[model samples]
Target: MKKEIVDPNYKGEVIKHDVAKYVPETEYVVKVLERHVEKAKHNLKGAPIVVAGGYGMGSKENFDLLFELAKELHAEVGASRAAVDAGFVDHDRQIGQTGVTVRPKVYIAFGISGQIQHLAGMQDSGIIISVNSDPEAPINAIADYVINGTVEEVLPKMIKYYKANNK
Candidate 1:
């Protein structure tokens, strides 16, 4: 009988999917969660939102809208691996297969091309909104709502509208 391989690159580093491993310190995990909560509070007050993207926005300044929106919502900002690798965002803010996994109230994907690796980290967000110039961008398929437009045009309008209404 031939045994089917789960992954050709398993490489002995991954824990088995069906196996339960001891984490050794539940307190440590709790402390880390608490620290994340505190830092998010310190940075965002009551906001618990995260924005994710790639460098598809075309320019660094254009990409600033993600952070701007995050600030407006008093939320955290995150990016896909490509965004960080391309220097559009910092490594600490990278989310995806090799980065932090986030469970935020809202996950906004702005100009993100939305590779599957990027989606894996944020697919469970309570709400997901994607904005992209390309209507056919892969991320749109997974988004709860898709805004088809340039981030530059869409973000400013959104900011203005929210600011006017909320104030």
Candidate 2:
């Protein structure tokens, strides 16, 4: 132990003076105690339906239609990595191998072309419905139904139909 001139109230600290040069390593183990996700409209992992969009949505203003459709379907909102990176949505809402995985009963993808990373997260969904203008979009391969239209053209109709039918 050595005293330092820096502090008036100096607490003795252990000092290693003559020590062999050695590399230090760290090993960590994480145990799951309890898994908890807040129950909310946008809770992706637990929602029975997920309404997801992608960079193909074009802009943040255009991307917002997914939220309206999600609300009508009582679904959560998710986004592709490209959508999150492009500032169309938040990272928490991202779904893929790099983000949260969801196996919802219904996954309605809007504008997403289904990058392989994204497919990993949502492929287990009970039913996948893709809405894209691209008839050859990779997402179409996995989807149970494919709507050959843009989200702008399809989402309003979906929301309107759901709203009217709910009444």
- The model with the greatest TM-score is 2
Q: lDDT for model 2, on a 0 to 1 scale? A: 0.89
Question: Which stretches in model 1 have alpha-carbon errors above 4 Å?
Answer: 1-47
TM-scores, each model vs. reference: 0.69, 0.76
Q: Which ten residues in a row have the lowest lDDT in candidate 1?
A: 37-46
Task: Extract clashing residue pairs from model 2.
Answer: none
Candidates' lDDT values, in order?
0.76, 0.89
How far off is residue 26 in model 2, in Å? 8.7
Candidate 2 lDDT at 115 equals 85
TM-score of 1: 0.69
Question: What stretches of model 2 exceed 4 Å from their correct place?
Answer: 1-41
RMSD of 1: 11.3
Candidate 2 lDDT tens digits, 1-167:
49856877778989886533453233225557898987654578999999999988888987777777777888899999999999998899999999999999999999999989999999999999999999999999999999999877888899889999978
